[model samples]
Target: MAESSSTVGKRKCSQDRQVDEKPVPKKGRSLCSTGYGIAFTMHMCNFIVTAQCTVINITMVAMVNSTDHRFQFNDSTEGLSGDSSGGLNNARDTLPAGVPVYNWSPQIQGIIFSSLSYGFIPMLFLSGYLAGRVGTKRVVGVSLFATSLFTIFTPLVTELGLVFFIATRIAQSIVQGSVLGGQHALWEKWGPPHERSRLCSISLSGTILGTFAIILLDGMICQTLEWPFAFYILGGIGCVYCPLWFVLIYDDPISHPWISITEREYIISSLADQIHVSPCKQPLPIKAMLRSLPLWSVCVCGFTHQWLSITQIIYTPTYINSVFNINMRDNGFLSALPFLVAGVTGILGGQLADFLLTKNFRLVTVRKAATFLGNFPSSVLLVVLPYITPSYVTTMTFLILSCGLSSLCQSGIYINVLDIAPRHSSFLMGATRGFAFTAAILAPTVCGFLLNQDPELGWRNVFLLLFAINLSGLITYLIFGEAVIQDWAKERKLTRL
Candidate 1:
């Protein structure tokens, strides 16, 4: 089965009669309305328009309430009341002896939460297979509704047992995965080729922005309210966002109603060959994928990069606090700055990649240089971080700069995905992530061990070991990470035989 349902090439107009084109390609004269066209574009656009408006409204509400911390994330009267009953307000009795003085529960929970986070990768891959069977729109709609229900009910569960906590996290993880998988398939069909990168950047940037918002605002909120309210606020945002997705999003470009003929033609011409549409052919099998050496190369390189990212996400806060002797409040604020920098840099990197493409740079060269090479420098900087120990500000600035540079590689990794398997980019992306997230799962655990080694050399060794791994991955890509799918496949078959 082909991933997409419609083709971009010239199709017969739907109407029996033809007329000259107008500025916006008047709806009356649309090919969709003509007898030859499928009306896919018209239907899709109308849905997306509705969904976008809905999301805008939800954002306003979420952000508005977020600004008021009292309703968001602090300790509640109930929590305080319970604290008095449990500990009777004693200093040492309130929290467990080993735990940090400040609210350490949520920090510990964040680590546990991250473990569930990688479940989305497998869930996404599984969802992609299902989407190929059912219509993408149907799967997305059902998944979104399921996600919303789970999100809404999360606040209702007051009991904080390990089972309940893990269950909620797992459910949310699966939903997040489905959302990405469905959205990826939808974009492969609806997004114009020329606009794919920009549109994708815009859409996924939400995660980055959301992280920033949570870090910046959550601090303020948690200061005044209960930790449970933090989860409630985040869940409510998801609930609001889910409904808007249904209204605004369409599965394919041809299904959209609002796009002009000229725009449709442009989209078709740009992406027609890339988005496959064969209902007769069998879907690519897992065995066939395993035999593809190029795919394996992608998996390895992607895992390498992702492991580094996961390490940073999990341990960077610990790094800042231990290395700089920073307070929790300042750590939250400073931690956000790196992500904010990364988000900005990532968008710029995408633009730079496109610009380089215009200059006739091979996609492989551009991706390799921009992303893989960028990682090398970051690794080098990280290795040197522990060695420098004069001022806190100087050390932190370097760490931030290192992470900011590493982010440039993110766009490059996905861009290479398109280079290798344009027709099955989403499936390949799922495959890459499925393999990569295993490393993500281990990154934190390994970091914990390394950091816990000897007090003096522990953190230093952690940075050194991680840097070496990063450098080795970069070298592997330099030597063997072929970007051209056909060439890579050919070379692999020869080696195997």
Candidate 2:
């Protein structure tokens, strides 16, 4: 009556098949999964792009402050005269005593400072669209490479003519503008819902770090070698980074060859609720997006942040030199100090925001709290800074506190795009950044006009203007911003006949 061995084996195999056919429960998977490759790639991309964009500003300061007649190119000596020593002495005597020998006037200098934003504004939306259509990997990689090529040629272009120099700068800005949009598009596929704030903060903090590193190193390079080396060194770094970026990064977890199956599944499953349809199939809801009040509030907040930050970036060195009586080398390091603090605070603020969300705090509350802490205190400090006397230590302390506090917004308004429209986050970010760059374009001109009126009083007015702008943005966002996903974000269901 005992069953044959072959029959027993067959029966066991059938039972195993039945068990395999049953669906695994989704609840067993973890809610959040952080992928190391995506995070590291994003951080590196942001760091390099930002360094390329800001290095020119530092180089300009060094050029204007240089005592070398060759940098100014004011000498009329023809191709190494027979008496080289006499020619050198002649060039020195031509320079006016107690006056800087730069060829550029203040008006021309202002134009140069604002030119980058001109190209940056128009390319924002296009970058997002291209990223969605093609892939972020190609878009960002090509853009970074093009920007680097232009940066490497900056010194040569400057010698050509003012118009050519401005044109070159504008081209670089256009390419660099794509980086943010491409990053946001990449995040749509890679960033887990719960980990968005932390990832975004870590990546965006690269801007601060880039600024700090460029400013800190530019001074030494200018002093040790020459002003043009600043451009050569930074541009060379960007060129080197491009190859690594293409080799290591992919658009999404599903496509990444090296990612583990466990991590891939976790990312795909977590994103399912947010991205219902393939991004390519989902038509961008331009009408609904334009009408959204929350999106507009985000744009306003971005505008304020960019205006304040850009003004500081362009003018802070001059402000320090004028008020503290420091040389260009010293000014570079001192100016870099505030951004160093901002970069560190940005990471900490992001972690805190993610932690609060994990505790079940409402998204709106967490965002608003971070923004308030970031902008309000910084605004108050800036208002007080102008009133303080010309003590280098005291002024620097206030500047550091102001910039450092403002960094909390990296976790606040900056991360709100992902919450509001996870699928369309790249386009939303592009729109907001475009508006912000508009502010960057105007900030230098406005500061110049104010400074021309009176140095001390005009500078005070600039700080007051920033305070008002920051406070207004804070109030507007607090009233209108919402962190919840809008109904328009959902794909429409079709009824088949």
Candidate 3:
């Protein structure tokens, strides 16, 4: 009887142990089996914010080309018989019906376009700091909402006079500037190591899509409805997107209520090698980051990149209209084509970059290759643009290729911050973007002065400036940029217990 009882107890103990040791498969279902929810929402957020950044491109073009404004000729010119002047005179005579131009001069227009950067530059650090402390979801959500509200009020602000209008735009710039840095912070928690490049690329591609959409729609809206409707429509879309962003996004997978156990586990495991710190409790390694040479290289490249990009965005329509004598409707379509090409190539470039990285190519080599391919070809094409005769189709083709090829940089310097310092990427991004906006402040003003001097000669000078700046960025980045994280970042000393 005693032996029988002992045997039964031992058997039960063995069964219990088996039950305890058995693995329980994660029961929670991912929002998407492949984790597309976070990716999709990030992409959407980028699209909305970038649209705000670029809507002015099309709106400004429409306003400048409107029929309500009077066209002035250079009083000092010897003859109005030059082919360029004659072409412009004929184009002005054929202005489309219902186009209403604001009588703002080129300089005023440049100020209006560049005003956003004034507000944009100062807020970069603040936004990143806030995102690090409070969490990106709240910071980004509020920023977008405020930006949209201001955008909706743009027409009223414009009616309030030039001073008030510029003030309002500056306010808008300050608000929207937060989005970029905030998103970078969020990616630290959200982007997986292997998929980081693709994710960042997809999100950034929103800028291209936004630019394309605004250009395609702005012209038609200005012609069919009124210029103010362009503001209303874009602002309304942003407003609608805000609620969705708040509902769908969480700062980290661990905190996301709706995330699956499986996906959460996957994210945590993938990011295990990266140092994680609660931003609220820890200080950023400001001294170390500032001392890092690679970071400064990124900033320098960003400065040059922004100078070229802002010039292209703000002036492309003007260039097309002034040089080729195209109408606003045609300008809209042609301007959008380059961004369309860019949008597609940006995705492809990102995918290819990730694939190469996975193949064990040297990180520095890949980055330089991508940057060279994107910047050098685009610069060559831009230099050729001034030499090309004024065939609308040919000019459009060159512009499209130049812009499209530039998308390859998306795979290079654009996401390099995330590579070198995943934990501090948001702050680094802010630093880099601050430099970019500073360049933005200068580029348009310079272009304005140049274009105002002589449209033909000034444009040639502008293209030449672009070529020089683009090449400089490529050279600097190749010489100084690094993909590996610095030892200071790896120390993880900034985190508090």
Candidate 4:
């Protein structure tokens, strides 16, 4: 996508000059902020939503093979600790007595894993447009509740057939696309300019924590009851969360019933002039956005980051199990541990970015530093992971460090969307995420193909590709990314029909 000038509205050059003439103000803080409450709700929403997406990763191992079909692996393949496809045999034995299995190849499994994003991508822009008009609170509530119900029924869909299961997954994700962009809209109304990173990152970190908690829970649930129970349990939790959301969430601080006077004043005052566009009415500057290299540059990182992230979220459990013969329960613990670190670092990176800005660091400087520090080490570590195969302590260390560091790029790339265009934050989020999420579709299929082509070197090839992508992404952002709002992104007075 490229930005070019279009005649949606004439720019108010004089008004823009007057606004810029006002003295820069000091940042404000309040003792009791309602924004934090909304942020936390979005955080929990992230957790449950992401958990649903990743639950299949753990359960797929059980779906594909049973102890009855021991040699799922080719004879030349050196996997399963030398026990005739050891991972599947143990996974089968670990499950409760009656679960059925399918004879799906790695390529077929890749399509299944990548299926959700296929639906999610197209719905992102449409849902975001709807949320801006119908209200995020309603859109998000319906979406969260529906996806939860779908998750609860995932196993039943599986019984229907492979195509049905994939369809169900896609349908579930289309609902989730609403929740993904809704929070960015919330931030435009509630977040103070100075607190943007901290607030947004706090909510976003829930995605990492959700992935961690679900993987851990999936193993235990699979061990105790069965694979289907993991979906039922998490889905049940999400259903319960839905009611709390409706009671608590509002579009903006002014409309929130529980917001204290002082906090409301603080938030409204702090964001008084920064957010100018009305997403409900403003016609996006499509040509201008198309021309904005900075926006697209940040988007590049979004793409590359998702490439690595989707790979980790979808395949980590299988990788650990297949390569090291880790049992289901232990595999869960190992796969989840890295994400826990990532969650912490995500918040820390946000705080760090905010601190640098508060202390007068150039916005581009902070962005470049975070982007480089975050991606470089992680890319190197991912590539190293394949080289140092099966080294238990070292492998775990690298994985954790890589995940933890890579999270900082969220602060760099994502928040920049709001930085340059708060007026279009939700729509931009949907657009950029739509672009980024294509990686989610590609990563699994590509990984599946690589693994299928050369079982022994497939994992190596995957990591090497991620490293190249990450490096190129960082270089792009360093060269073109900017923090200040672009002229094309300026608020324009739109004529309503």
Candidate 5:
């Protein structure tokens, strides 16, 4: 993962020269009708935050008991007033205590639902292309408004069969992807170049923070009211956000009257030399993009790291309850620690990566260091976990630290997208996420299938599987995971054969 001297020289000149350049005023770019674009971006950011929260809250509750498999919305009804006559009551009967929640049916359903989040990537990949043909502001505003509507209706689909549940989740997923993809494209139009990472981190961090809010609030609601109420409350909150987006978001800094002149110049000058591609009117070379080794490496890296993460986030409560005999409510509180830690670590990790770059460290060196710090140790810990015989609190402390370290991979994977394919960052992100999410769909089912094979031994096997995949990723990083482009893309152009 070392950067070549030539790459370093090129980057130094490009970055340093840009750092010292005079600002370019964006006087001609209209600022008359951009309030909605600015407001929409912020609004979309907030919606993602809420969705992430809802995901974690519902997942934790769903897997807690085997026989009385209550969905969150269902649980809320029972908690709020003991009126569980609908699908909630029916699903509850199916999930009585002592029944293992890791059955085939729920496993399949979990895969489909979780895939919604990952599916957002493809939606985003196309959005840039779509926005270019249409208008950027129009695409974002309409999509955000539609997405919020779906988020609002998610809880209302309180049916017993799997169709309603999966359909609602799929609908939510499509909308979520639209908002994120649209927002990213829109932000690229407006965000300052040097500050892109920091700004992107801020927007992404909202997701993590929103998740933290959901976990704590949902936990309280689950304890005091019910799980369905958690969704109801989230849906209600989401409704309020849609209007705000319509009121505030803008497509580019220059377009927004509210943005200061200094801010607009700084933004335009930052990316003056770089291509500001409008959406593709021509079809994207998705196939060509997939064939590139550098891009595929990004996909494998994300797949490995995300698999480990999604598994932990979705199943940690199950692990705590089964392995240490902790109660559901206590597990919810303790389980939230890792996500919060990850949120903090995500910010720290991004800052740390930036610091390394500022010190003139090789891009490969910085990214590889972060990748190793995140994945390698977590792999080792998964192996060692089986043998730990500590108290419940001590054991979960290990779990918390294990997940926190994984945030390094999250930061590394994201930054690496920009480093390797700056021109196609959005497309690459989409392609990588599409491939990696197959793992997301698989993690739960694999865990379930394995556990079902031998309840006593399957859990241990799951850890081993996680360890193996993570190690495979570590080796990939060691061998082929460079952050600097190293003329890989250039070679593709020259050797077009």
Candidate 6:
């Protein structure tokens, strides 16, 4: 059943009436409202938790050095051993056998680097459900605490053995996964329709920022103090911040004791049709979703976007190494540049999107526009990248441009779940995000295969293939992606999929 214009009009009118009934505060006061505060805290939570995902990768060198023998990464890195400043020796003095160097093969190191991915996926779907059933506050709150605790103890665990270290990383990732999708559920109650895009983008931008921070800083952190200090400093920040999250954030606006009446009324009125004040659980509408072309459009967008994103994130260093002949240290800074730009653009895109809405743009129009703006140009650039060889300035420019623009998708399909089904937004976010992350595994394998086929043409093939995949999503979403709540997604009966 399509939502008729009459129904749409009613929603608009309802929103208007509510605004009339309880006016939002002045612009200055609204900026400081509790909803924004919650979004900020969520951003901070994402910053630290997502950083934990990459801590192992960043500190691998220092960790290897923390073992019994001297760490000689290569003949070229020999200068690193005896530097007067914080080098291997400095770290060694600080952390005496803190991380035992088992005969961990390169394969084991690869697994440890990827162990967080293993744990992150499993908890995505479950966290979405538990956040709604038990409580978002409890789920997110405990997750931070656990993540911080694990991060803080990682050095101790590594001292025990490699197996223990890997296990702790995985366990830490398990809890860290919850905060990813769990936070979306809160938007149903806390975010007004016009405000949702910016709020969600603001919170999610933390992922990009956190990643950049870790990549940029943790290398120095490991070089100066030791690998353990990276985890310690980051984890300590999380530990201190978790209690504040509990104090400041609430599952819903109404439940927040400190919220001004004006803000609470504004949120409740804006979300009246979507929020389920009384909690209930029933079977998910799987059958309904099977018929949802719009849902599939979103899933495709999520997958294709994530596929390309994961590819760039993992292989950018390799690309720079081979194509630009940049040194390893320079590669780290250059590789992180895209995410930093993306984070900045995501926030700016968020504001621009909301501005469009305020100017009376249709929600679908804005979403589709954002999706197109985010994907089409980037895909074109990506497909053409292989043709432009050995131009460091040009290649780096386009690579950064391509990935930076992709962040606009955060305002598109990223928050579309809330638009379509606020009650099930968290679950949908998890399910779709989980579907997207499948690309994380597939991207590496596919890139490896393509590269193995022909060293030169292989890169071209990878680009063309990714472009084609991304194009399919762009086409699908433009045609079929929607922001309307499905009938099955609304208050439901006791029906199984």
Best by the TM-score measure? 4
- Tell me which of candidates 2 and 5 scores higher on lDDT: 2
Better of 2 and 3 by TM-score: 3
User: RMSD (Cα, Å) of candidate 4?
Assistant: 5.3
Report the C-alpha lDDT of model 3 over 1-497, residue by residue, as the tens digit: 24565455433322101111223223322336434576667777777777777877777755553321222222333222322234443443344455455667777777788898887887886787678668888988999899989988998888778899899989988988888766777777777656666777777888877788788777777666777888898889889999988898888888889877878887765665554543223357888888988888888877777777777777777777666555557778888888889888887888787677666666677777887888888778877877877777788888899889888887888778877877677777776777767877888888877777775477778889988987887788889899877665653322223
Per-model TM-score, in order, reads: 0.73, 0.85, 0.86, 0.90, 0.76, 0.81
Instruction: Show where candidate 4 strays beyond 4 Å.
Output: 1-32, 66-89, 277-280, 492-497
Give the per-residue lDDT digits (tens) of candidate 1, residues 1-497. Answer: 44222322212111111101112111212234321121222222222222221221112112121111111122332333223242112311322223212222322333443555566678767776666566566666666556555544644542455467457757666765665564455555554433444444444444444454455554444434533455556555555555555555556556766656765666664554444454433346567667776667667767777677766655565565444433334555766676567657765676676566555566578767876755887777778877776366876687677767777775566445655655566666666766666665566566655544454566677678777777776776666655554432111111111
Please rank every candidate by TM-score, starting with the best. 4, 3, 2, 6, 5, 1
Better of 3 and 5 by TM-score: 3
- Which tens-of-lDDT digit does each residue in 99-211 have in candidate 5? 22333243554555464565565665666555544545666566655655665555455344456756666666666666555555554455443344444554555555565
User: How many clashes in candidate 5?
Assistant: 24
Count of steric clashes across candidates, in order: 34, 0, 0, 9, 24, 0
Better of 1 and 6 by lDDT: 6
**C-alpha RMSD of each candidate structure in angstroms:** 10.9, 10.0, 9.1, 5.3, 8.9, 6.9
Per-candidate Cα lDDT values, in order, are 0.52, 0.73, 0.72, 0.78, 0.57, 0.72
Q: In candidate 3, which residue pairs clash?
A: none
Q: On residues 1-497, what C-alpha lDDT tens digit does candidate 2 reach at each position?
A: 78676555443322101111223233322323336556667778787778777776666655552222222122353432212242333322332343222466444666788998888887886787788668889999999888888888988888788899899988888998887766678778777666777777888888888888887777666666677777888789889999988988788888888777988887776666666333236578989988988988988988888877887677666666556544457778998999899999998898888777666677789889998888888878877876877687888998899889888898888878878877677777777888877887888778766765554476778889988988898888999999877777655543333
Error of 3 at 255 (Å): 1.5
TM-score of candidate 5 on Cα atoms, chains taken together: 0.76
Q: Model 2's lDDT to the true fold? A: 0.73
lDDT (C-alpha) at residue 59 in model 1: 20
What candidate 1 gets wrong by more than 4 Å, as runs, is 1-114, 132-158, 191-195, 390-392, 453-455, 485-497
Better of 1 and 5 by lDDT: 5
* Runs off by more than 4 Å, candidate 6: 1-29, 57-113, 155-166, 279-283, 323-329, 448-462, 492-497
